[model samples]
Target chain A: MTTMRTETSTGAEEVRPKSALEPLISAENVSYHASGRQILQDISLTVARGETVTVVGPNGAGKTTLLRVLLGLISPTSGRVTSKPHLRIGYLPQKIHIDPVLPLSVNRIMTLTGSFTQEQIQAALEETGVSHLNGQSVFNLSGGEFQRMMLARALLRNPELLVLDEPVQGVDYLGEAELYELIANIRKKYSCSVLMISHDLHVVMSSTDRVICIDQHVCCQGKPQYVCNHTEFQRLFGRQFSESLSVYSHDHDHRHDISGNIQEKNQ
Target chain B: MTLLDDFLWRAIFAGLGIAIVAGPLGCFVVWRRMAYLGDTMSHSSLLGIAMGFLLQINLILAVFVVAALVAILLFLLQRQKQLAADAILGTLAHASLALGVLAISLMTWIRVDLMSFLFGDILSVEISDLYLIYGSGLIVLLVMLKIWKPLLAITANEELARAEGIPSVPLQLIFMLLIALIIALAMKIVGVLLVTALLIIPATAARRFSKTPEQMAVIAVLIGVASVFIGLFTSLEFDTPSGPSIVISIVLFFFLSFILPAPKTYVLR
Candidate 1:
């Protein structure tokens, strides 16, 4: 039942001085119980106006439940969640199964939740590099293409907060890094706050402002480098895993082209 | 004047009204895979009829009340997670149906035609029944149109829709109520046993021609209307049962759909 604050450490704050602002969403001492099992216990976290916070945890760690709570889809068993008034959020679920009986096209999915102009739809699809898939049936999308289509669909709202669960579940290794880079670009372009759940511990996005590791509770919370070096992270995912995380962080000099070929960083 | 006075014309008009509404509503039932839920609600309508006869109230109103209650009970029962969903539906469907039969048997004073109630007597529809069909049908269609986008969003991905601030629970309840209304209205045309078939068959037949959900719905309505027309005329010509004939016509259309080439835009995965 430990409560952890997501206050940015001083050194990390020095790197991105303007990252902190009024919190867009915050949860206090939130705990959720289902079927007599405690799924989440005494969890506390906050996402500021322009910060990207990634929650990394093992399977069955209640990460998705926590996201659902923050999104106001479900109320917590104890404690409360507060958010800014009229906060607009774009969400990409882990997976969306469009039944074969449903005849939904990718173009139609863009307008499923809200009205968007044709130009807006085109822009959102082009931003995610899936404009070619506009008229295609959602049921026929490839894994990577489907993820991109969902990302585009989420962006049509021009949300102030982006909540992505997994985001790259069915994508290949090469596409995973590209998708993360795309997310980083989207965050920069829109300057929207991002709250995401990542299962990729070895390649935790270097652009992440903070990383919170949890297994039914917050194990550690701080900058990605700080959490990667902490004993709690090492204990949860072995020391070997932590070392690989650091290695991945240092070798982030290259970027991938759309064709999956690595290009040297010009930035 | 002759057309308005004839029973055959009245039956055709009543069937058309039900078919038009059933087209769009049935698409949701098929998409959500709630054909069994429709079956359960329609089955409970027989209980509504038995109670109506006992209390001397309007049978349609009684049926709507009972079906709506069954819908709410099913919703609550599903949240419990103890019994499997299909098992609960099965228990409720048959239990209410058998109870309705027993109740009707106990009322030996009233002359109830169990055959017509089970398999429908569409040819004997009165003008008052036509008024009920169109009145409630229009309301259901209007309400469905109002919630069309949000309902489709929820059907595609409920978590995403809820996260994006569509009230999924209330919308689902409203959808269940709409189904109950449709079942209550449809009971007179197709009876308790075949109402779900009227809902599910036309929607399935329309799938081969549609590129979008709205297209599917529109095509389903056309298919349903065509089935009713053909089935009625076939029954008139051969002296067969009208409701079963309609169901058979739709089943034939479903099979006929297989002969057409697949829709050019969709690639089945």
Candidate 2:
């Protein structure tokens, strides 16, 4: 069960009562439970303007659910979720998205994403470096190509915020690097916010403005350098903390063994 | 040629209108795997026709009321969250059809041409049907054009459409309402028993050949009009049912589409 009532404010959304600069998205005490067990609890977070926040956690840490709630796709069970009114948003879900029966070319996909002139479509495609795949069928795109295609679609919106889920999972190094540089360039070019989900924190930590560490819920959050050395993270995730050394969030301060369950990774 | 020309011209206009509307809507049905769902709505129009006869109401108006009511009921039942969507649609369809049969059974005082509605008397359709088909066809086709971008946006992903300011829910309802009207009006010529066949076959045939949705819709309309004419001619020569004749022509087109290689679109299922 959930409740959503509008709060009063100067602008459209009552959530922005304090000031217009008070973050576009605010989720307070959001909890999720399914099958009589809690999957997430007490998650509070805010996404400020032009900030790219990456949320990293072990599998099933409710990362996707959080994204869903943030995008207004899902209702949180026990908390308030609000966003700026008329906020333009673009989203790319993980997995290859192809409506096999939808007879559409890459150009058609861009057209349906939002209304755009042909020149804008071409420029968006060129910017994302997918101009060659313009007339190509989306169903036949490779992982890297599909990722770029989604970026182009999002770029067509000229959104205020972009939410991408697991974009680099299946791509190789060049593809990953290309996507990273594209996001950086897009940020500088458009000044839009990005909330991306990534397991490879090494790639994302340096790029994003903030890092949100989430386990069952938000474990801790701060600049990447701050959360990496927190003691609570070391205590809660025991061995996962050790094995995830390649992650930008672990430390070498394990002078004593708290648990024998620790697995070592190349630090 | 004047007498023959009138029939041919009317058939062309009527068939063209139905094809354009049904082609794209049928794509939605196929993509959503709503085969049985389409069948249910078509059958419900039968009960609507029956109710019209019992109430001494205009047959088309009766159809509008009954089909709209059933469409609304089925949509509501689908929201139950307990029953599978198809099951809800199935129960409503079978029940309404059975009620229509029983209503016809008890009404011996008044007579109704049930076969005309069931099997569709396209060969005998009045001039008013031509106007009705074309008028509704224009409205549906134009509305489909105006809403085409946003409709695809909604159908592709409801949440995504909403977030993108598509107003997905109300627009989806409006689309469903147009589909109800098309199914109701098309029933006069295509008949209820096999109307879904006419709606789906051409779209499927076109899907096998086209690379984009807009192209697929256009090709589907062309296929539908061609199938109708071929079926009419074949039925005239062999003295067979016009609906089945149209369906068979579509099947031939389907087979030809398969034999002649085109880009694969996963249409087997």
Candidate 3:
């Protein structure tokens, strides 16, 4: 399940910042280069109401860079980004590391907002079915538990736009299935737009409505089903993509696409 | 008490005042893992000290101004098109320290027991320095209390904090300002090299004894206070330098905490 396309380079300079367009996100003529490497190119992109955008590309294709820009963590070399007001944003990072000696636990992490009451923390842990871990040290949490803990944290924020960077990394088969199910349920309950970086094509493909193939450029953008059948998806990524063989977990030179390509090209 | 005793009490008051203010802000430095950063800034304060002597201005204000400028320079260098934040901190630390030492050497009038100032003898504190320490520290601590929540948010994740509408740039400036204040006062008590121990070791020892970050911050103060007492006594008995004596006491506590068999689990809400 993959969507492919050609035309990998495009500049997004013409984007306007009109706040009334019902566009959750608009990136116009954005370009970014990190460590003398071209991570993101001049690209125009937009996400609208009820849109779930999946960014996919080979390893180092600037998927992370685009996400950083969306999160306002990194400034683009050139380009203007505009977003709707107070866009209840929730983000799940690639991984959470607490240094073990930091004295942070599951409950502490879940209560990160600090604006939340104890009852809210209890409710989030209950919803994520991770109440048992409330007392556990974060260092002892398994990969799946850690992921669910992070999700529970995001839920505490009550965000309308959920952004996750590779939520299903290093998880067991049952855990992965449970994760996807949990996401579907969250979307249904909250009716929030979901933007996540994932490499598991077999799992995310059928579920994603919008697919944007980014390979240091805008390769293609359309509905997931259309992308799965597109000739462009076939040329760049020909694999049928088994569920067991995921991205970036292997020891060899692995390439990752959170459905964002990880392609490294010097700008 | 005689007039000399009044002066002694004033110096001690200055010491206590600085400890109170630095206790909380120092915890943040430890939380952000910026202990070495505190040392770097404290070292930069020497440049300000030298400038104060050369320019014939108030030493405290000069130290604050110069160290704060160094902090701003650090922030700008961090945003450099090519340099990383860590690299900028490294270069500023060394360059500023050397310039400070060189500037100090140029002043012949600065012959007043330089070793005590360097190693924290605390015998020369004036009434004005006491007032300065308490007043500035109180204001800084009050500001810190007001912004504590947002500060914690930034410490967790900078980008995430900004996305949630927290102004990280301004917050970073405030953080650096508090750090500069700490450097200005702590430089006298800790010497530039030893100030980081006050920020890091207390927090490090506190981590084993507390559950949440807030609790750790509080415990760090207590731990720091304990080390101060131990150090003060040891220095009096052995006639050793107070700065190094305090650091040694801090290290001793750390070792003791590590060697003692800790509980299997601790519950912190």
Candidate with the greatest TM-score versus the true structure: 1
Question: What is the Cα-based lDDT of residue B167 in candidate 3?
Answer: 77
Docking class of 2: acceptable
Least well predicted 10-residue stretch by lDDT in candidate 2 chain A: A1-10
Candidate 3 per-residue C-alpha lDDT over A144-244 given as tens digits, one digit per residue, 9 for 90 to 100? 98888888889988877789888888678899989988987897787778888877766667677788877887877777655655444543576344213
User: Which DockQ value does candidate 1 get?
Assistant: 0.65
* lDDT for each candidate structure: 0.86, 0.74, 0.73
Q: How close is candidate 3 to the true structure, as a TM-score?
A: 0.85
Q: Candidate 2, TM-score vs. the true structure? A: 0.84
Highest lDDT scorer = 1
Error of 2 at A32 (Å): 5.0
Q: Mind giving the per-residue lDDT tens digits that candidate 1 earns over B1-269?
A: 57858877987888898899999999999999999999999999889999999999878778889999999999999989779999999999999999999999999999999888887787658877788989999999999999999999899888888888788889999999998888878777777799999899999999878989999999999999999999889878998888898899999999999998886767777
Q: Model 2, B132-178: lDDT tens per residue?
A: 87787888888888878787876665655665657765776677677
lDDT of 1 by residue, A31-88 (tens): 9898899999999998999999999987898999999888877778887787866778
Q: Which stretches of candidate 3 lie over 4 Å from their true place?
A: A1-22, A34-37, A239-267, B1-11, B84-86, B267-269
Model 1: CA > 4 A from native: A1-19, A247-267
Candidate 3 chain A — worst ten consecutive residues by lDDT sum? A1-10
Residue-pair clashes per prediction, in order, are 0, 2, 24
